[model samples]
Target: MPTLSQQLLAKEAKYGASNYKPLDVMLCRGEGVWVWDLDGKRYLDCLSAYSAVNQGHCHPRILAALTEQASRLTLTSRAFHNDQLGLFYEELCTLTRSTRALPMNSGAEAVETALKVARKWAYQVKGVPADQAEIIVCDGNFHGRTLSVVSFSTDEPSRHGFGPFTSGFRIIPYGDADALEAAITRNTAAFLVEPIQGEAGVIIPPAGYLARARALCTEHDVLLILDEIQTGLGRTGALLAEEHEGIEADLTLIGKALSGGFYPVSAVLSHDAAMGVLKPGEHGSTFGGNPLACAVSRMALKVLVEEGMIENSARMGRRLQDGLAAIQTGVVREVRGRGLMIAIELDPAAGGARRFCEHLRDQGILCKETHTNTLRVTPPLVIDTDTVDWALDRFSRVLSAA
Candidate 1:
């Protein structure tokens, strides 16, 4: 008889939608920054599930929390209060230094929650008339796969045919504070932005752009909402990426590494005036604050703060950036990143990014391509210097040939 893994693979091939063009490998187990495929091959994970596993996969602390909570109780539907939800809120609020939190199940949901909160605050607090509240977004931003999120996306594939979309969003060129100011209006309720555009090939705004954006939002009485789902929780060497700019947003969306990939856990965190607008039953999810996910997220937060992972991310991220920059390859156009979220934008005429990614996979480095020609290299924060050097050597070899 074929093994269970083989049977599962067959089933997936036969029934699943081919929406994802993943690397031709099936992983069965992961630890720290490495994953083992079904055939006993090991690969250094460079994507980290788009920074969702910055704490690394199956982290012992989070795994124990999940197991312990699963043994006790998994779900209570948010119809009744759970001990872990309050604890999760306390831990996250303490870590983020925010006053209120609205838990959700995914990054998109958290972003949607923030949008709703911002619009409500606009009408209820800022006195913008109903349906006139507009949100400003950036050109190369990626929030999530929700309708409202795609409504502001400048990416054609993410927006095409996904609408007739939601309204009340305006787009401006990223890093251009002048464009931001031009886009703002009295009816502008919020400025929704990703501090560093992650899926837009790890594009970092020009220095002082975030600070200027914060000033503009405050100046215009608009809420500054940062979608930090891909950049938060030490992925960019900070609990929140905005901290690097010494600016604070009125609302922040976080997910991904919030639960260390154990489960889908996201939250909309904000100050009292912004989040206070969310009255009871205005927004919620059945599994948003479930005990199991909350317990796991609590442990994940502890590991991020206490285990010195953020420092490691900063250190290793520099090593990675320097090493990739040092690679003498003509195909490499530029290396840009903050913390562990790095990207290598190749010359666009060099064929697509997928071929290079497939080559890296063959070299036992599991990385992925993004946009059209940028290769995003985000590994787990637990990676050590030796493994990084090894990965660099392999990357250098691959790019040299390309």
Candidate 2:
């Protein structure tokens, strides 16, 4: 006879696509920063569904909003206006400080939306030749997994077997302003980048890299699109990671945490010029701005501000980083991150990160390994100092053993 966890894993393997290599534990419920396994074991959720639960899992306010809106009305699509869509737009724009907002169901859809808008803006506003406009992208970006999104990916694993892909995208090394400058041309319509590369081992860009990139975009009349799907809504201490660099993107992509992990909500926030090219019937989604998503996102944003989660992230992040740095472990090669999106890079000679992650998991701290050698530790923004310290103690023990 198999244990419940074993049975579930086997069932998933037999029935589902083999796209993910998840841990052995099977989570049944989550609240705030902790999740319970089927066996009723409690573990600190360090990954937060790749920062989607920054407001913490099953946030009461967001859950209430979801339930309330769902009971009243759910999907109206884009054909007819829903009462919640306009308020959603207003609140999202005001929060992100953008002039226009295009709602979508996932981060990939928002990325696709931005690409289309940028290309159209290039042809119509920048006088670029039709079908010739190019968009610059960073090398280690993980925007999304769509065919078009994967078209520009530099990761061989992501790009393999996905082509022949869409054209009009150029790649450059991340955090290199000079490389970016060299890559640009009159046909360049936008520079699509992650403010901090999240999936590529939580890589932080060089200081002033964003400022320089912003300046270059302005000089060349190219739109700057910041993909903040993983780093936005207070995951990186600030409301948006772009605020750290004191720069604003011409277009910003947000999702994951937008509905506080209660729903799949994403949006492309644009300045007046970038989004102005899209007329009605040009681009839309069936459930992009559905009433339920709008209502849930509204509550998510409100609670994030009212609960002081952003400030908590900053303070807790500093504590986490300091603790990681002070760990007396020779296996640790480096510790880096912004806010709660931290990473521990192990020495190549010390073996891969998976074993360390497994050890931590056994000790009840649930984080994930990235890029084989780095452990990404992104807790919920609502996590407290004591929980962080508890997690750190487990991390210290695991790293020491490794």
Best-fitting candidate, measured by lDDT?
A: 2
Error of 1 at 121 (Å): 0.6
Q: What is the TM-score of each predicted model, taking all chains together?
A: 0.97, 0.99
lDDT of 1: 0.91
Model 1 worst lDDT run, 10 consecutive residues: 18-27
Deviation (Å) of 47 in candidate 1: 0.5
Tens digit per residue, CA lDDT, model 1, 222-341: 999999999999988887899999988999999999999999999998999998887778888999999999999999999988999999999999999999999998898999999999
- Stretches of candidate 1 above 4 Å error? 1-10
Stretches > 4 Å off in candidate 2? none
Which pairs of residues have clashing backbones in candidate 2?
none
lDDT of 2 by residue, 253-334 (tens): 9999999999999999988888999998899888899999999999999999999999999999999999998999999999
**Candidate 1 C-alpha error for residue 269, in Å:** 0.7
- Consecutive 10-residue window with the lowest summed lDDT within model 2: 349-358
Q: Could you tally the backbone clashes for each prediction?
A: 1, 0
